[model samples]
Target: MSEVKLVAIFAENKTGQLAAITQALAQAGVNIRWVAIASSEAFGVVKVLVNEPDPACEVLRAKGFMFSLLEVLAIAVEDQPGGLDAVVKTLARNKINLRNASGFVAHGRAVLLIEVESAAKARRILAKKQLHILTQEEVMEF
Candidate 1:
């Protein structure tokens, strides 16, 4: 799988927090590709994959939003049973520990963004199996 940039925004779980974040990004014209929100009572963590992560980061930074950039692998898998199994098994066999992951289906494909111990090794292993790894541009296509 190839590496993609993910932006993490830490904000209060109260109202207007996400509004301000999205508004700033929208004002800067950052096209958000995919977004996931994880929350408890106090705070929420918003992870986003955008068309241009670097520009998004700069825009949010200037807006005074608390955020960070993360390197995540975008892997395109089959939209059928055993599809995820094949990918995860490959990484597991290679001694790569999966720390966190998120997935979504679009264009009839199951796209998974994974955080692992060794992205390079995971890419090599998937490459040998002829799996498709998404680039930044490709991710936007979805």
Candidate 2:
């Protein structure tokens, strides 16, 4: 899989938190490509893979939002039954443990952003299986 720099945004896990973040990004002209949220009562983390990571980061920083960057793998799979299973099974066979994963389907393809024990090794294994690993440029195109 290709390497990607994903943004981890920390915010309050209450009403209007997401809206405020979205509005700030909108005003900054940044577009969110894919997003996932992990939350509890006190706070929340919004993991966003945006079209322009730099601008998104800048906007968030300007607004005094606490955030961090993550290096992850982006995998492209067929949008069909068992497609995800095929990719995951390969990792399992190699004993690669997944930390977390999130995906979205558009343009008839499913893109899975994964954090695993070793992304490089995972990429090698997936390549041998003929699975498609999405490059950062490829993701921006989507």
lDDT of 1 at 2: 41
The residue-by-residue lDDT of candidate 2 on 27-132, one tens digit each, is 9898888888888889989888888888888999999999998888888888999989998898989999998988888899888889887878998889899988
Candidate 1 structure, TM-score to reference: 0.88
Instruction: For model 2, name the residue pairs that clash.
Output: none
Worst 10 residues of 2 by lDDT: 1-10
Give me the runs in candidate 2 sitting further than 4 Å from their true place: none
Tens-digit lDDT track of model 1 for 1-142: 2458889999998889999988888988998888888899999999889888877888888888899887788889999999999988888888889978889998798898898877788878888988888887788888
Candidate 1 lDDT for residue 141: 83
